[model samples]
Target: MIRNPSWVLRSYPSGMPTVGNWMLEDRPIPEATKGELLAKTLWLSVDPYMRGRISQAKNYATGFGVGDLMSGGGVGEVIKSESPDFKPGDIVVSDYFGWQPFTTIPASSAKLVAATDAPVEASLSFLGMPGLTAYFALLKTGDPKEGETVLISAASGGVGQIAGQIARIKGLDPVAVAGTDAKLEWCKQLGYRECVNHRTSADLVADVAAACPNGVDLFIDNTAGPIHDAAMLNLNTFGRVVVVGTVALADRFDQPDIGLRHLRKTLIARARIEGFLLDDHESEFETAKADLLSWFKQGLFETREDVIEGIEAVPYAFVRMMNGENFGKQLVKL
Candidate 1:
């Protein structure tokens, strides 16, 4: 009998998660049932959003409890199919694949990865949730206009990098706010109009103000903390703010985020701030994927991945990503 090695939540953490919070155990490999497909995971995504899954706070999605299998998005090869929509050897992507080498999922939950020049792992990065998040958040929520200044926080990150490039493609000026000099340099390579190392800036508000002298028209906020304050302080009239991820506040999700209130700045700028979730825009995923692929084929899209090997590294990868240590999309290759 084949055994599946899986990671299960050991205990919830009070602050930053550690490897100690997870346990690896071997279980019998599950067999695909009627209307289900079994797959061998090729790549597993470790995103900032996973922080919420282990927290006691109520998240938009159901939170994982102790003993629950650590779950996230993954790209895999279908090895056993009990559904007509999938067959052995087909590549598929699903959001529910736990931290295991093999998974049995309902056919309805899996999407067949289209054959593209890009690698199969791309289905978990730029061509997957991160790309989709960047796409709709910028175009639909941010409502970017040509020549407008769009400031993106965490600009070298998975979603942030793609968001910056897409803003540039739409003829918008993108100002990147990242943690390290290396990250800022990479943002420059991605064609951001300006880059600011948030870690080195003496006054982030001044830096952001200087970057967008004309005032920011759109703000793609991924790290909501001091960066959020700086962007709000420099927002233009009728500026749009799209709140995607709050990685800066990951450790304090259960605590109140006390900071400078943006009510005055918001009122003065008439800024429109809205939170964005990819799940809310699932109806247009196919459309977004098509557009992203088209841009990629045109050589207008570029992405980076920070990957680790083995399932045991998944927890470490997630912690590294949340710490802003990973360069791009963090993944664990099985």
Candidate 2:
């Protein structure tokens, strides 16, 4: 039997997780039972949302229990099957899978990934959760109109990149806010009309205001700290805010973070702010995926991925992503 190495939660993290928070353990690989398939993992995703799962605090999703096998979205090739629906060499993707070399999953639970000109890794990033998140949040929540200004936070990140591009496609002007120069440059290349350095800008409010002279009509917020506050201050009379992620609250969700109170601004602007979780829009996945794939094939959409080799790198890769050290979608290749 092949030995499968899996990353398991070693402890609940108090702050940013380290290697000490995880343990790589080996276990005997087993054959698939009836109606199941055995898969060899090829790509595993590490996202900011995973940070919330490791914490004890209540999040939009359930938290991972201590000593549980760390699981997330992954792409794999079927190595063995006991079901008629799958055969050897079939490619499949799962939103629930372990960070391991191999996994035995029920055939019905995994989805088939059709062959495409784009790399299969896209299934975990742009074409997967991140892309889906961007599509739904921008189209449904933010709802940008033609010629309107859309501002995106964490603009070089997985969902942010796609969010900006989708806004541009829908005839809105996209302005980006990023932490680093390289990330700002990436936002520029993705067709952002202006990029603000939220990390170094002396007066973030003024900086965002200058970047968006007409005021922000739509705000797609991935980080919810200073950027959100500044966006709130610059909202148009009929603006919309879609709070999709909270990277700014990483490792600090247990504590209340004080910032500008924007109630008066929302009240006067007549703006709407809503929290968006992707799972709430499962019915919209097919429509979003089709639109994203079409734009991607037409060269209007593209993605950047930061990949680390080997399953052993999952812990460090996740930490790097959580710390905003990864420039794009972060993944581990086994």
Find the candidate with the highest TM-score and give its number.
Answer: 1
Give the runs in model 1 whose Cα sits over 4 Å from its true position: 1-3
Task: State each candidate's clash count.
Answer: 0, 0
Give me the displacement of residue 39 in model 1, in angstroms: 0.8
For every model shown, what is its TM-score relative to the native structure?
0.97, 0.96
Off by over 4 Å in 2: none
Candidate lDDT (C-alpha), each: 0.91, 0.88
Cα-based RMSD of candidate 1:
1.1
Candidate 2 Cα RMSD after full superposition onto the native fold (Å):
1.5
lDDT of 2 by residue, 19-127 (tens): 7899999977757899888999999998888888988787878988888888888999999989898899999988776888888887877888888877888888888
Tens-digit per-residue lDDT, 116-162, candidate 1: 97888888888899999999999999988889999999999989999
